[model samples]
Each structure stands twice: as structure tokens, then as C-alpha cells.
Target chain A: MITKSIMIVGVGGQGTLLTSRILGGIMQEAGYDVKLSEVHGMAQRGGSVVTFVRYGEMVAEPIVEEGQADVLIAFERLEALRYAHFLKKDGVLIVNDWRIDPITVVTGAAEYPENIIDELGRKHKVYAIDAMKEALALGNSKTFNVIVLGAAAKHMDFAKEDWLKVIEKTVPSKTVEINQKAFLVGYES
Target chain B: MAEKKIMLGNEAIARGAYEAGVKVSAAYPGTPSTEISESIVKYDEVYAEWSPNEKVAMEVAIGASISGVRAMASMKHVGVNVASDPLYTASYTGVGRGLVLVAADDPGLYSSQNEQDTRCVARAAQVPVLEPSDSQEAKDFMKFAFEMSEKYDTPVIVRTTTRLSHSQGMVVLEERQEVPDKPYERNIGKFVMMPGMAKGRHVYVEKRMEAMSEDGGGFFVNRAEYRDTSIGFITSGIPYQYVREVFPEASVLKLGMVNPLPRKMIEEFASKVDKLYIFEELEPVIEEQVKSWGIEAAGKEIFTRQGEYSANMLRRILLSEEVTEAQAAQVPARPPILCPGCPHRSVFSVLKKLKIHAAGDIGCYTLGAVAPLSVIDTTICMGASISSLHGMEMAKGKEYVKNWVAVIGDSTFMHTGVNSLMNTVYNQGTGTVIIVDNSTTGMTGHQDHAATGKTLKGKTVPAISIYHFCKAIGIEHVVEVDAFDLPLLEKVIQEETERDEVSVIITKAPCVLLKGNHFPDVCVPVPEKCKKCGACLKPGCPALTKKEDGSIAIDATMCNGCGLCMQLCPFDAIAKEPK
Candidate 1:
């Protein structure tokens, strides 16, 4: 099988680690040889962070290089715009239409980009979800990443029940029900 | 089929250590290497600890090894520098049982201050280092490294880069192989590193190196993958994966043991391939040695010795193929900052208000050097802050350093900042040292330290008091102030700095992310009370932003109820609204 590459881009402390763990769990459940590369420590303190997940019959590189990602799941619009080039020509771009002004913007060193989702749509297929708004509507804002994952689930090979099983196992036992419901919200959307 | 589970490279190494029957493990928390001890501590059979510093950790492992048990010490690349004193000597003394160190290097400077390679240090110490490519090899090579350590009668290092340490891949689970502990023998000539004894052991070290080099090829860790003979790459660790990604069918001489060059394997691989290239991250340790042997291999010339190597790098350099991919959008860089209610922000804000530059040490406080607060002037490793401030005082006299205060986290202070403070006391240097006591270690993801009153295994222990530590070190004016209490923090800092004697201000606050830390209040903006004064935004907290109408607003989700802005607001425009 050809190696399927997925990139998760977000601001640190945006629950990217949990999202990647959930992603890794689903791929492992699918019995694919998966390699996930993550960054921890300094980068986790409100900085831009990215995790690379590649799975196939035999995966080689742990990192998904520029123009190699089959799916780019970004939690922030600015982050999506930043890592847009990493997406393959036909790759799906799933962004959680949210904005968290970076320190540079907070310090007025640089301007936050405008209409990032639309700008990305100009060149690539974009699936933008207001996961945060939807998650807040669901009464839990942290499960927004799972919703974004659900939105991207329509493109992946895994089944709904399989995704539910992994999500249940991946999240805390108390969070299992809410997370499953959140995933369905995205998956059905 | 074996039971295979996905594990992070660090976790796999821990599993390998468990399988190898390591009895004791010690380490200081550092990126890439922290999780190794973290993962291993879960095994009931193995005893693990968070040693205050890398040197202490290395020596702890060495002591365990001398006590006839298999032991290990893991630390990041810079930590290797701290552990080097013991590590260099251990290479000669070797192990009583099997001693292995996991030194994770950050080639890309992803989480480090510098991109220092561990292999370069291993080579200087004359130790054999194993480089594993994936989680499976990270586990397998760890077992192999311990065996090699006992076989060669020399300490061995398993060198992993950030990519190898952080990546998660499939690893086959294996049962623990219980290795018998060797009975301790009194060999004063070996254990005791007297100059005379060291002279004899030094000769043995050279012989051990020669033996390791000769037998290196036979060690299963080094192998040749014969595919297309047109191009051959001699690579190791994570770079090997990149090689496989770029040239799937190309011949590769993968060296798991990187320190001692397997000459025979290199010669055989070089003879078969028409062109040979050495692909290694950071320093040209392998390429220089291979080149010295009168073998021509292209490395570091076309390839950079900086940062991480990638498949696209090989495609661009080797094939000379230009990537026509879209350029990454020029966006505002999201540099890591102190979290919304980070106590460092409060301390740094006070320092900024007083226009006092801080000599910063490692940890989250280092971010204070960044814009807005910009209170820190210099940062040079852990514990350097206190000593460097003392140095400035010695150089420019006592009054010169009054403008500068040393700032270090509680964990970092316990690491080595305590010693620097002691030195200041001994040497009669006057400088105000701010022990930003965030209780637990910050930046490295909140690992507990000695002062935090907890062990790695979650055991309750008497936490060391930084205030008492400063007092015990003979500092006359040691005081503690609440970090969020800005006026008190500013007053204490100013009072301490103005004192002619060495003084310390322990700014007390637990990290906001620490378990049991409750912020029941959120900083809410009173837009009507706002006078468009940018007083609150001076610290540049990401949570506080100015609206288009020029009035400040605090994002409730982001506002950690730090109340620094509330304290900073002159017109009482911001209030700490209960969540």
C-alpha cells in the first residue's frame, strides 16, 4: 500500500497531542504500520506545533515532508495557512476555522492573515469547520479537535464504529461519551 | 505473529531497558530524554528517579553499576555536557554489570538552546554509541548496547536524536530477560581514578577502543542493505529513515553503533557502490573518519551539518531536483510564551517595570527575554544566571550589578542555581537572585523536582524549601513573595537588589498547569472604566488584546485570571471576575 501521510498543525496547548494520540490509535486499530513524529517541551508553550503521521504497508520516514501530506488537519486558520504548502496537490485540508493570535501579532510584530480558509480554498480543496463553536454548542469546547477529526474522517478509510471504538479507548473513560458524540457531529457533517 | 504495539521511541527504549533487566535508572528532566525515565518508572521491577542534575544522575547510575547491577542514565545533549565529567571516567572504569546511557541529541535545535551532537561528545569520551532508527530498533539496539557495554568492558551510549526519541512506531513486545547481577569486586586500580591508576586504565581504554573497532562489524547492529549498487549511503539513527524514504532500493551501510567506525563494513559497502555518501545529522563524525581512512565519501559538503535532514533534502541535493511546491505563507511566528497565568509573567512584569535586566537561566522564565517584558538580558545554560550576575558584580563592582537580578526557576535553582548562590555567598558578591519558584519544573512539561516535594514515582517526600536553601547558603536577606502580588514582588526585588550583600527573593507560585492549581477567577474587562491606556498590554500577554476601538479586552478562555493586567491597569478597567 502506498504510504498515507497526515499532518496535524495547531498552536501548542490546543490539544494537538491528544488529537495525534487519537489519530495514532485509529491507525493502529486499522492494523497499518504507522509512524508518528511529535514535538514536545518548548514548542508546547503556546507556539506553533505540528505532528506528522504516516502509515502504510511499510512506512519509512516518520516525518511527512513538504508536499507529501495526504491530509492536513489544522486546528487554527493561521496555522493552516502556514502549513498549506505541506499538503499534496489533491490533499484534503481540514481546518478548525479558529484564530488564536500569535505572540508576534500580540506584540504587533506581524499582522494575522485575513480570510485564511478562503485563501487556502483558492488553491486547494478546503473543509473548514467552526469546531470550537460547535464544541461550545455541545457544552464542551475541548472536544473541538475530535470534531475536526470527524470532519476529516469522511476522507479516511476507517469506519464509524471503528473510529468510535478508538475514540473511546483513547480519551479518558469519563470523556468517552462526549468525545464519541463530538466525533459523530463532525463525521456526519 | 508477535504482539506488536505502537510506542514512542523513548518508550521503546524504556521497554528495552526493562527487557535488558536494568535494575536502577536515574535522569534529570530534559526534552527528548525525559520520557525515557518517565516510561521506565512504570515498571515495578525497575527503580527510577529524577536526579537533580545530569552529573548526579550519571554518578547514580555509575554507583549502581559499581554495586553490581545493570543501570542507566538518560539526558538531553546539553545534559551530556553536565554528565561528561563522570561519563569520561566511566568509559575507563567500565561497568560492574552493564551500564548504558541514553544521550538524546537535538540536531534541529527543536527544543534546545544549541544543536549539539552527542556522538561528538561520545567520541571525545572514547565511548561506543549506538544509534537506533525506529522504535523497534530503539528497543532492540538498547538491549544490544547493554550487551556491548559488558562485552567491551566499557561504558556504552545509545545516541538518539529528537526525531528518533519523539517519534512513535510499531514495536514488538518482548518478555524481560533477567540478567544476573555481577558481584562487586575491589579493583582499586579500576574504580579509583587516581592519576597513576588512571594512567594504567587509560592504556586499557585505548586497547578497548581497538577491540571495539575490530569487532564492530560483527555486532548485529551494523548491517549492510544491498540493493542498487549505483549509490550507497552510510547513515544511522533517524536519518536512515530519510534515506529509505528517498532511495528505497539504494544500498545502505546502516551503522547502529556510530562511535567506532566499522572499517571492514564500510570498505565492503564502498567497493560495491559506484558512488558513496555519508548521511548523518549534525557533526561529520563518521564522514571525517571514513575520509581519513583514504576513502572518499561526500558529506557535509552538499549536505548541511545543521538542523534535521529530510527526504525532500535528499531529493533536492542528490537528484538536484527543485521542488515546485508552493512557498509557505509568510505568517506571524508563534513563538512559545509563558502561559496566560504563568507566574513568570508576574515576576518579569515587575522586573520590566523597574527597568531591571535579569540574567536568566533555563526554564519558562527564559521567555521573559522576549519582547514586551524583555527583562532578561542573558541566558547561558542552567544555573548560569546567579553566577553570571556575580561575575558582572565582580567585573563592574557591586553597584554595576544592582541594575541586574538573577532569575531562575525553582527546579533549575535546585539543579545548580543553589551552588551558584552558594558561590556568591562564599565570594562575597552582591546580587539579587530571584528564585521564580513555580513549585514544579516548567518548560519541560511540569515534572516534579526536589523542591516540589514529590518523586518521579509519585511518592510523597519532604519538599526542599528554596527560601530555607537560600538562608542555609548564608544569604542574609532571603525572602519569599507571592508572584501574583506584583507590588510585593517589585518591592522585594528592589529591596534585595539595593542591598550590598547577596540576597534572594523567592517569588512563590505554583505553575498554572500544575495539578491542583485552581484559577477560579478570570480577568474580565470593564470597557467603560478603560481610558485607552496600554498599561495592561505592556507585558504582551496573548490573552489581552486591544479592540478596534482601542479598549483592552481579555479573552475569558485565554485569560487565566492572572490579574497582572488588573494590577497594571491604572483606571481599574480590568477586574478579576469569578469564573
Candidate 2:
């Protein structure tokens, strides 16, 4: 049984939790034993948030130890860089080309790396997408996560129809159409 | 037929409570433990409530249990400190029906003030503690805890750490069992805890512990798995998973019942294995007990008694494997911040503007101590703000308190600040108290509280006004002002500090992040009139940022337009962007 660990990294309120849930749902639907772990409370206040999703015949722990993640789905550029260690040397990196400056950077305590994508791309299999831009094209920036997940879905073994079906059940009925469109844009990007 | 679904450890605990025939559930919202009660509320068979604090929650659950119904109360580890008084006494008095207390410990200090272990508290109180490694066990152990509680006639503690509580795993759900409630019988000797009765009960407790210790060896929960038998790992709770992940072939003595130390099982496992290692997080509770029993086991010495444990950490410790270390990046730290338009931002901005040393309390307002504002001097605990301020005046004299004020959140002020304020009134301590009333418990994901005018079941109730409460509590000069009204708030703070008597200034504003609560107006910078004096950035509102051209820009999507940044602008360079 081959177990795959996917680390979803983003700032709080970026729908990272929902993304992990959708991935977990997809894996569970595929009859894979899935385990998802997330951090709540203080970390939800615009801090770095990482969710771990492990799926296979069985998963003992929900956490993805350093260098064990098969794929890294990052919602922000800097967040992708921050959790780069969790990704295996041959891991697939699906990063959103968006930078939300940290408090230290805004306060001039530190600088936001200008070439984070380039640096990550040089070392690993990096797929950078402007998920925020894609979501904006769909008329709702909140769908940015769905788009990122859509991009990640292309790399995964899951079927496209199955991803859409899960998204339909996972998201609200009112925004189903927009979210589905957003997911496609992400998948194709 | 049982249904299988993926659920968080907290949700599984709630499902367990429902299936275990729990009648009443109460908890004060704290991280990791908050969702247990929240999820329990969905089951109509159980009456669930969000108590004002953990102590009140514990007492309420105890009251339900004494009424002959199974009851459960939950809170984060620090909250156990608040609930410990009732817990210790309840341990002596026992229960009419079964009672379970869930103490979700945060070992890594993830979202907590400290990394205190709940198992230590359970040991001190002579209560049996159950630790679950996964969601399935989280559910199964909750039901087991209730059975053990009734069987032993004691309040059982279900100890879980952040990893187990927040993690999601597959759980097999079962039908809710209708356990008949035991009739209430008032026996003073058994129920009441007079010194004489307590002494007898204490001896009974000792006897119970001994019985549990002896019986624990054969209990199915305290099982031993022998594989290679060369390396034995004794672990419980989330650490058990790490041990299994790192050493799949090694023998494991996974003790589900953490307290009362399954002594015989430990001896048996220790005897069979050539090498013995204890893998427990936070405290060396098991390690100390095994050593006292004359069993040599290596634990805390190899694995530091701090933070959390990972598979890599265990592998490095046991096999001396060179775990891959990622090159540390000098990335800017993304510390948690107040939401873009948090009401606390305005209050801190005033405190910072006045150069007042504000004693802080726990909640979202504690973010005020972060960069740009930095007004908070001390944040010891829940109600430490008022008491700390009073202590400062007593130590440094009244003159020193002239430029100082204690700032606490509305929920925190209600939690324990009232008592602290009462102490000030009784002792005639003169220090200003500012209650940042954001209408909800903003810190713990906006759970409704007593002052929020809403119950756990979403029922509207008469909200307790903090302004009136302060006046009623002997605070002569109590003032209320909108948090966004910078001039008025500043004036009130200055006036309140100047007055000799203890005063309160309630800065009233609903948390912007609360659902259906937004200002509807977003402040946009007028680039033509902009002179980047950086004054608007002082509040550190995440929505407002200075561009490379030295002009301020607001992310319209992120900004709720509370207009706090607009009020902070020196020139008329900011205005509400038209919808």
C-alpha cells in the first residue's frame, strides 16, 4: 500500500481547511483510508496555517513529517517557501503566485523574498499559478483555493469528474457554478 | 450496521458522548476543546451549553451528574486550572451517574499560554485519565470513560492533546444507547465533603486507585503488541502513533488508560523486551512511575519533555538516523494578527497614542502587544490585567499608574475580570480599566458568551451590559464609547485615568470578523492628497498598507472599512470607497 502525504500551506482564512476537506473527501470516496490534520485557534488569525492529508490503504498518523510530503499545495508564495522542507526532494510543488506580506515584512523587520517562485522552481518540480487572478476572473476571489486545488487535482490520480462532484457537495449551492468554473481555470492553468 | 465517516477528534468525542447516552454537556470555548461541545449540541438527546468559564462549566456538568444523568464538560488544559477546584472535590464526592471531563492539552503551546499536561492534574486529583491516539479511539474511549466513571463511582478525565483533538480520522459511528438514569439519592456522607466525610472518601479514593491499577493490566484498552520483542515502546495518546510510525516492527505497549499506570502490563512488556523506551509527550508521568516500580525505562532523557513529537523525531532518537534537515529560511515571521478591521485595533491605537502602558488580558486584544501598537505591558492570564494594574499602583505608587490602564476583552472581562475589578473596588485601588467590548469571544472563533445576548443553542437572551454591570459593581464613573470614535475614546481614556477613583471605559464595537457584522464601508486612500506620514499604519490594520510610492492603499476585498485608518490619517487623505 503506497501512502501519499499532501501538505496544504497558506495563511489563515485562505480556505486551506476546506481544500484539505475536499481532498480528504475525494480520497475517502475513492475508498482510500484518509486522515487530515489541521491547526485551529490562534493560527487562524492570519498566521501561517498548514493542513496535512494522508491517504492510502491505511494512515497511522495525520501529520506529514519533514521531507515526507509527496505534494505541497501552497496558497501563497511565501507560505510555499516557508513549508518547502515538508516537501520531498522529488515532491510536486503547486504554488499560487500570490504574496501576502507577513507582519515582519510590513513592519520592515524583514524583506519579502522577490524571487521565491524562481528559487523553488530551480530545485523542485514547481507549478506556479496566479490562483487569485483566476478566481477574480471567475468573479469571486474566495474561489482561489478551489482553483489551487483544481491545479493540484491535475497532478493527483483522481478523475476530473470526481473532483467536480466533490466540489459540488463541498461548496455552497449558490456558488457551485462559479466554483466549478474556477476549478477548471485552475486545472487548465 | 454502523456508519463510517471521517471526523475530527473533537467531533468524534461529541459523537461518543451522544452514543454513550450522555444527558448534559457543557464547556467554555477554548482551542482544541471548543468543538467537542459545539458538535455535541447537534444531538437533541443531549442538552449542551457554553458556560461562561471552565469552572462554571465543570460545576454545571457536576450538577447534571448529581441529578442522576450522565454529564460531560470540556475545556483546554489551562481551563482545567479554573475547573480544578470542583474537579478535586468531585473526585472525593464521586458522582450519582457517570461524569467525564475532557481536558484538551496543548503540548506545543500552539494556541495556548502554556504547555501543561492534563495527566498530571488527573494524577493529583486521583481521577482515572483516558488518552486516545486517533479519532476512532477518541470516540471509543469517551464511551469507555463514562463506563469507567460509573463503575468506579468517580469523575473520569479524558485527556487529549492538540494533535489528537484537531486531527481528522475515520470513525465507525454507532447508535445512541439509551442508558437509564439512576435515581438521585441524597446521602450526606457520600455526597457532601465535610472534613470528616472527605477523610473517609480520600481513603476510598486510594482504594479505588489500587483496584483500578490492578485491573488495568487485563483491560483491553491497556494492551501489549509484541512483534520483534527486541525494542519495546511504551506510549499513549498521539505519541503512540509516532512510535508506531517510526518503529513498525518494534513491540509497543500502548496504554489507553494513562492514569493508574497498568502496572502489571508494563511489567510484562518490560520483561519480554530487551530494550524498553517510554514515548510520552510533555511530562514524564509514566517514566517516573515505571522507575518508581523498579523498572528501568528510557523516556524524557532521550526525547525532550517539550513541544510535540513527530515520526522523524522518534526515528532520530531510537535508531540514531540522520533525519533530513531542511535549510532554515530567513523568511519573515507571520505571527497571528488582529483581523483587518478588528475593534481592538482602535483601542490599542489610542493607548499607543497616549503612550499609556496598558496591562493586557488574553483574547484577540492580546494582539495589541504586537508591532506598530505595542501598548500592552503584561498579559499574565485571563483576568490578570486588572489585578496586575492594581499591583503596579501598589508597588510603584499612585503616580506611576497615571499613565497606565488595564485593557481586557468583553468576554475575558466577564470570564474573571469582574472579580479582579471587585477586588479593586473593595481595596479602594485606583486604576483605570478599559474593556474592549467586541460583542463576542473573538479569540476562540467568536463563540457566543453571556454578554453576547445569545445562548449555545442560538437562542436570543437578555444581554448583560458591561457598562451597567461595572457601575453596579461600585465603579462610580463608568463610561461607554464606540471604539471607532478615536477622539471620544482618547478623551474618555485620558479623563478616566486622571480621576482618582477606579473607572471603566467600555469601548463598544462588534468584531468585524463576526458573520453578518461588517461596516459596509471600506476606506480607500485618495492618492492625490496622500502624504505618507505613516500615521494610518500605526494601528497595523492588515487592510491598510503603504505602497512603494509612499502612498497608502487599501485592499478593498480585505477591508471592512471600519474607518479606523481614515480617523488616524493626519490629512483628509482617506475616505469610504463607494459601493
Best by DockQ: 1
Would you estimate the TM-scores of all the predictions? 0.99, 0.99
State the lDDT of candidate 1 residue by residue for B132-179, as single tens digits. 999999999999888888888888999988898999999999999998
Encode model 1's per-residue lDDT on A15-74: one tens digit a residue. 888888988998998889999999999999999999999999999999997888899999
Could you tally the backbone clashes for each prediction? 0, 0
* Chain A only, candidate 2, TM-score: 0.98
Report the Cα lDDT for residue B126, model 1.
95
Clashing pairs in 2: none
Label model 1 with its docking quality class: high
What lDDT score is found at residue B305 in candidate 2?
A: 85
Model 2, CA-based lDDT? 0.90
Q: What is the lDDT for A154 in model 2?
A: 93
Query: Which candidate leads the pack in lDDT?
Result: 1
